[model samples]
Target: MEPRPPSEWEDRVRELARQFSYPPAPDLRSRIPRPGVRRPRGRRWAWAAGAFGAFMLALGILLASPARAGLLEFLQIGAVRIRLQPPPTPSKPAATPSPASGAIPETRMLGILDLAGETTLEAAQAQVPFPIRLPTYPPDLGRPDHVYLQGMGGPAVILVWRDPMRPDRIRLALFEIGPGALIEKITPQVLTATTVHGRPALWVEGPYLLQTRSGRWELRRLVEGHVLLWTEGEVTFRLETDLGMEEAVRIAESLSAP
Candidate 1:
């Protein structure tokens, strides 16, 4: 019979194993037995076998857990992870009621102003651990109209620029997520693998729910624009705009410390 193909679980395990980084081996030469010292040859082999067994046990436990499995399904890029969930089921409409009954209340969509932790750009910069970067491509594009400091493992800085012609409309928004921070998106319309400055990146076209959890607080917003996600050193950037991919990439590449 032909060789059997690997199962999904097996494939996932192999992928994860490739990404796993093991601790550096300690310097054993200095600890080796001196001229007068005597040690059993089988002792070293037994110790090595024990350590390998323990590591395998831990890996098995994590892979077998449901919670961990869910986390493993996400496509992670730096501080962000995108998970595709099944589309929500549509609800059936109810029959219209008489005048005696009150009309159903309309659900209001959340906008940039509705987000919490609003603050001045200077204040946001001071609060975050990472340096905030600004795009220099659009020479006329000045400073951000609004700045926010929100939590995602740690404090994340958000900068929003509004259209000069239409002050009420946002032109662009940038999220600077530093080390330990994480952003998750659920069921985006499209996700394409891309690259920026030779580093891996993700392009997400959205009308999806984006969420970030920190301690007891959880923030959720509906994203309607395309997002370019990339990382530079320890900082992860998320640029949201209505512009096409080429323009977005140019803007991303023009980021500089301000």
Candidate 2:
């Protein structure tokens, strides 16, 4: 039998198929899992955790060492670093004559004349590169009784004031250490953090061993009074006095170049 003529519905379906467009089929061979191959998941997270653990282990080992622990327990301000130390041992008393037996007790005082590089204030100012400053808080405070200059890589100027009543005793001393000079203080007492003229400072009480080092010179002094340490510009100021913290800070804030 002869094929029947195409119907209208058949013609319409053919026309619709011709007008439609389709995308090419994607290749699935590469994406399919192989029999013996395993993919690594979360590998980045595992690496991160291992690295963190190693850092923590190294830090713990460093903190456990006794000799190394002292390296971290210091406070540095300007050119000075203060370290905590154990209290010094007390010495046994020696036999001596009584005060009522016409014997005078020896008094130890800071000897300004014994310091190196003793010179006039004008001479010190001429030798140093930085300006010399003096405090004006105590209106009656006059000029320094003595001035000393130390060559510690750079110039270190010291100004000393003597008590009028007790000429043998020192009333105040101001140390101006320039760059390259280093000071190390060892104290058994705790140090208090303070501020002078809004700048950071350190207040140390009681007696301490003060050591200063330069190129080839090193000096050690036993400081009996309190100390105020701070930095202004490139110079570090150390004020040694018997005054309280509030008064010391006030004096520090009143410093002016003269």
lDDT of 1 at 15: 57
User: For each candidate, what TM-score against the reference?
Assistant: 0.60, 0.59
Give the alpha carbon lDDT tens digit for every residue of 1-258 in model 2. 999997554554455334324234648577566898665643654553464344233322322444543444445677766554432433654343221111113223336655667789999999888899998878878788888887655678888888889887888888898887766665425466566765567787543222222221222332357889888777999898888899999999989863
lDDT of 1 by residue, 1-258 (tens): 999997666665565445534445869888788798877764875664465444443343334454554444455666776654442433765454221121222322346656667789888777777789998978888888888787667667878888889777778888888888766665556665455664456678753222222221222332346889888878899988888878888898888854
Task: Score candidate 2 by TM-score against the native.
Answer: 0.59
Question: Could you say which candidate leads in lDDT?
Answer: 1
After best superposition, candidate 2 residue 213: deviation in angstroms? 16
Output the lDDT of residue 139, model 1. 85
Best by TM-score: 1
Extract clashing residue pairs from model 2.
none
